[model samples]
Target: MSLSKGRISLIMNRNIQKIFLLGLLVSSTAVFSQIQEERLILNKKREPEVKKIEKKKTSVETIKNYPPEEKSAVPVEYEITNVPAVSDFKTSTIQGEDLSPKFDSELQKNYFRLGYGNYGKFLADGNISGNLQNQMEVGANVHYISTEGLKKEYPWSSKQSSAALGGFLTSYGESGKFNLNAEYNLIDYNYYGIYALQPAADVDLSQKTNQFTVDGYYDFYTNNILNDARVKSSFLGDKFDAKESNVSAMLNLSKHAVQLPANGITMNADLGLGIETLNSEFAILNKNYSNYFNADIAPKVTFFSGNSYVMLGSSFSFLNSKNKNLLTTDEVKSNKAYWFPKAEILYAATEEFKFYAGVDGGLKMNSYASMLQENPYLVSDQVIKPTETKYNIYFGLKGDLNQNLKFDVNAGFGKVKNILLYEANGLFDNNATLNRSAYNFANTFSAVYDNGNVSTITGNLQYYPLANLTLEAELNFASYRLENLEKAYNRPMVKGTLGAKYTMLDKKLHLGFKGFLMSEKPTNSFQIVETPNPNVSNSTIYQNVENRNDSVAGHADFNLSAEYKVHKNFSIFALGNNLMTQKYETFKGYKVLGPQILGGVKISF
Candidate 1:
C-alpha cells in the first residue's frame, strides 16, 4: 500500500550500491593477507613481513672417481754385542701371602699347646707343616710330658714320663738337598730307689721301668766327592724283656787335592767310612747282656789359607766284643785293634775372629747301648769295655763380640783308659760271703773301670742388649783324676747354664728365662742286712771295699716363659718350671719333678 515512496527510495539506492561493493572486496582481501609487503628498492626503507616460500622440486645424480697406489718405507734396527759378568749375584726376598680366608696367616706357623699342673702335671706340644710340592716339605710333631710323682711327703715312688712323635720330609732339587727324619719315643721310670729302704716294703714299684724308642735319620749331600751320606737307626725296648738295636753308617769322600790362587794355598782330602752294630738282650733282674761290633777308617788332610785351616787325621779301628753266658757256660770274648791320631787347627784373626786347636783320640765304644746312656742304674752284668782316648787336647776361642756379642772359650786335656765308675751294690762287704746277688740291694749300681785324667774349662756366651733382648751363658769346669776308682764317683764338677730372651708388646710380648747349675758329685754307699741279723755278722759296714767315699748334692734349675699375643692365630702361655727348684737330683737316688707352674693356649693354623 505504500509503494510510492519514490519507488521505495529507488530500492534503497540499489541496495546501497551493493553494500558498497561488498565493502570494497573485504577491505582489499585483508590488506593483501597481511604478509606480502616485502619489497624494497628506490629509497628502500620498508622491510618487515617476509614469510612466503614455495618453489618447484630439483634432483641431480652424481658421478664417481677412484685412483691410487703407493708403497715405500722401512726402518727399524737394534744390535749389541756380547756381555756377561757376575760370579754370583743374588737378591731374593719375596714372601707375601694372605689370600683371605684368614686364620692368622703369617704362613700359619703351626702350633698347639696344652698344659696342666700341680703334682699331676701334663703338658703337650705340637707342630705341623705343609708344602707338598714345589720342592716338597712336610712335617708333623708332638711331644708330651707327664708327672704324678714325688710328694707324698716323699718316701719313695717318684715318677716320670716322656713321649714324642714325629715325622718330617724335605726335598729340594736342582741337584741337591734331602732330609728325612722319623721318631717315636716313650720312657717311664720308677722303682723309687727300692723305696729308700722299703717304706713298708710291699714292692710293686709302679712302672718298674720302661723305654721304647724308634728313630731313623738319613742324610745325603752333594757338592761333589760324595760329600756326605749318613744313615742312623735305633730301635730300643725295655720292660723286663729287654731288647736293643742300633745301626749306623757313615761315608764321606772329598777332594780338591790342590788349588792355589786368590786366597791361595788350598789342598784338601777326605775319606771316611764307619760302621757300627750293637744288639743287646738284657733283663737286669735276670741278666744276659753285651754284644758289639764296630769298624771305622777315617782319613783327612786339609790345608787352607786366607786365614788358616789345617786338619790332618787318621783313625782306624776294628773291635768286637761279646759276652755269652746264658747262665752256666760263661764265655766272654774280645778282639780289638785301634790307632788314632787326629788334629784340627783353624785360625781367622778377623772376620769376627776365631782361633781353634785340637788333638783327638778315640775308641770309646762300650755298649748295652753305651751303658744305657751312662747309667740308667747299670747292673745286669756290665763289662763291655773300650774307653781309651789317649789324647784330647783342645784349645779354642771363637768370636763375634760386636754385633751383639757371641763368644766361646774352651780349654781341655784328657787321658782315659777304662774310666767308668759307679759302685754300690752291697758295697760287697762279702754280701753274706758273696752269696747275695739279686742286685744285693744297696739299691744297685756297679760298673767300675778306672784310669783317668781329665781337666776342662769351658765358657760360652751370647748377649744382645736390646733389639728384643737376649742373653745366654754357659760355663763348665771339670777335674777328675782316677786311677783305680778312688773317687770321681757321680762325676760332675761344676756346670752352669743360663739363658734369657725378651721381646715387647709390638712383638706381642714374649719372654723366656732358663738356668741350670750342677756341682756336688761323688756317691757310693751300702748297708743292708736288717734285724738282729745285723750284729750277727758284726754288721757295721758303713761303706766297704776299704771304705768307698760318698757324696751327692748339687742342684739348681730354673725356667720361666711367657707369651701373649691375643690373636694372629691366638696365643697365651705361661710356664714356670723348677722355678728355683722344688726337686732336683741328676740321679743318685733319683728325684725329679719340680716347681712346675702352667697355663696354656696357642693355636695357629
Candidate 2:
C-alpha cells in the first residue's frame, strides 16, 4: 500500500508502539517468574525436613554385614563388710491358770431357780430347752409361786403353779414351719375383802382356778412373703363349787391376693374367727350363764415404695351372745355386727427418723377369766361382754438418736364402748329371807360396763452408754371422759417407769433397778346397813351405801435386783421390792405387800 509521508510515519510509530508493548509483556512475565521462585523457596524453608528411609537389607546380608560384638562377664571383687541390725522386740512366756473347759453362756439351756422371801413367799422356776434335731427344738418350763398374807390375820394367801411345753419345727420346702405349745396353770387365791366384816373362823375364803392353753401355728411361705396361719385355744375353770368355766378359741389366716400397679405393693387378705363362753352359777344375778361368739374378716392393700409404706383395709365382725336366766327358764339372745376401718402409713424422712400414723379399731372380749386375772378380788357375779374400740388414731416419731440411743413419742385418741370397770358390791337383803350365806354375802367387787372416750400421749427412750449397760424410761399420760359415770375408775392419768440394767465382769454379774409411778385415780367403796322402815312392812330395810374417791393418792415403787453368776450354770440372785416406799393400796381396802427381800440360787445347764 502507498501512503503519504505522514501516514508512513504513523505506521512506523505504530510498529514501534507494538514493540514497546511486547517488551513490557516480557518484563512482566520475568518479574512474575522470579516472584513464584521466591515464594517456593520461602515455603521450602518454612516446612520441616522429611528424611528418606532406606530399605532394610535381607536377614542373611544384614547378619554378614553387621556382625555382633562379643561380650565377657566382668568379675567384681567383694570386700567383706558387716551391718548391725536392730529390733525393738522382747519375747516372754505367759503363764495363766489352766482352764481345761471354757465356760460358754450359749451352751446353757436349762435353768432352775429357788427363792424365799421374808413375807413367807416361796418361788420355784425351771426351764429346759434343747434341740431335738437339726430342724426341731423342744422346750418345757415350770414355775411354782406361793405367798402368805402380809399379816397372819388377814387370811389372804396366794399360790400358783404353772407348766408349759412347746416345740418348734421347721421345714425346708414351701411348708415353712410349725409351732405347738401347751400350758397348764393352777392358782389359789383368797378373797379377804372387807377385813372388818370377816368372820372369826376365817371361813377359808379361798378359791382355786385352773387354766389350760394350747396354741398351734403353721406357716406357708413363698419367697419372703409371710402368709401363714395359726390357732389358739384356752380353757379356764374357777372352783367356786365347780360352777365357773371359760373356753376360748381363735383361728387366723392370711394370704396374698394380687399385685398392684406399682412395684412392691401387694393386695392381701386376712380372716379370723373366735368363740368364747362363760358358764357360772351366781345366786345374786338373774342371768348367770353367757356365751359369746365372734368372727372377723379383713382384706388389705399394702403399698410399699421407697421410704414410704401404707396399708388400707377394713374389718367386718359378727358377734352373738346368749344369756340364760338364773331360773334356767328364760333366755336372752343378742347379735351385732361391727365394721372397723384400718389404715397405716409410715414415712422415713432420713436414715435415723421415721414418722408413722395409723387408725385401728377392734372388739375385745371381756370374759370372767380375764377379769379375775386383772382383779383377783372379784366376786362370782360378773358380766361377760365385748369392749368395742370404735376408732383409735395415732401418730408417732420413732428413730435412733445415735448408734446407742433410741426414742419414740406417740399420741393417740380413741373411744371405747362397754368398757369394763370394777366396783364394790354392797350386801342386799329381802324382807322374807335373812341372807348371811358366805357365797351370797361375800365382800368382793364386781365388773361394771360403761362407755368412755380416751386420749393418750406416751414417750419411750432407751440408751446404751456401754456395751453392758442400758438405761430405759417410759412416760404415759391419758385422759378419759365417761358417758354415765362421774369418773373412770382405776384409769390412771399418768404412768411412768424408769429402769437401768448393768452387766459387769464379762456378764458374770447383772444389776437391775426399776422405779414405777402412776397418777391418782378413782376408787369405789360400798357398804350395806339396815334401816327401820315404818311405812313398809315391820321388817328392817337394807340401805346401800356407796362412796367414791375421785382422787386416790398414787403410789411409787422401787425395785432392785442383782445376780452374781458363780459358774456358767449357777447363779445367786437377790431381789428387793418396794425398797423405799410407804404402805399403799392399789385397790380399795387392799394394801400392797410391804417391803420384801428375796434371795435365791439359780442353776442352768
List the RMSD of every prediction in angstroms: 44.1, 38.1
Reference-based lDDT, residue 304, model 1: 73
Q: Give the alpha carbon lDDT tens digit for every residue of 1-605 in model 2.
A: 00000010001122221000000010011110000110100011100111111111110111111111210111111111111000000000000000001122232247777877765666666556666665566666565645564464354332222233333232223245555667675666555444324454445566566767666665443322444456656676665543555555555555443467867665545455555555554445454677777777766666656546677888787888887765668678989999998998878697468788888898877776667645656766666678999998989877655435556777889989997887766664533233354433435677888998889888766665665565766677888888998877866688776667676787688776666676776877665566787777777765666777634578776667788889978888887766654556555655555566778888877
RMSD of 2: 38.1
- TM per candidate comes to 0.28, 0.74
Residue 116 lDDT (model 2): 78
The residue-by-residue lDDT of candidate 1 on 515-581, one tens digit each, is 5566878877654443333455655333333236767687665666677879878877776656664
> Model 2 segments beyond 4 Å from truth?
1-108, 152-174, 195-198, 223-226, 241-287, 327-329, 428-442, 528-543
Please report, in order, the local distance difference test score of every candidate based on alpha carbons. 0.52, 0.53
Q: Pick by TM-score: which candidate is best?
A: 2
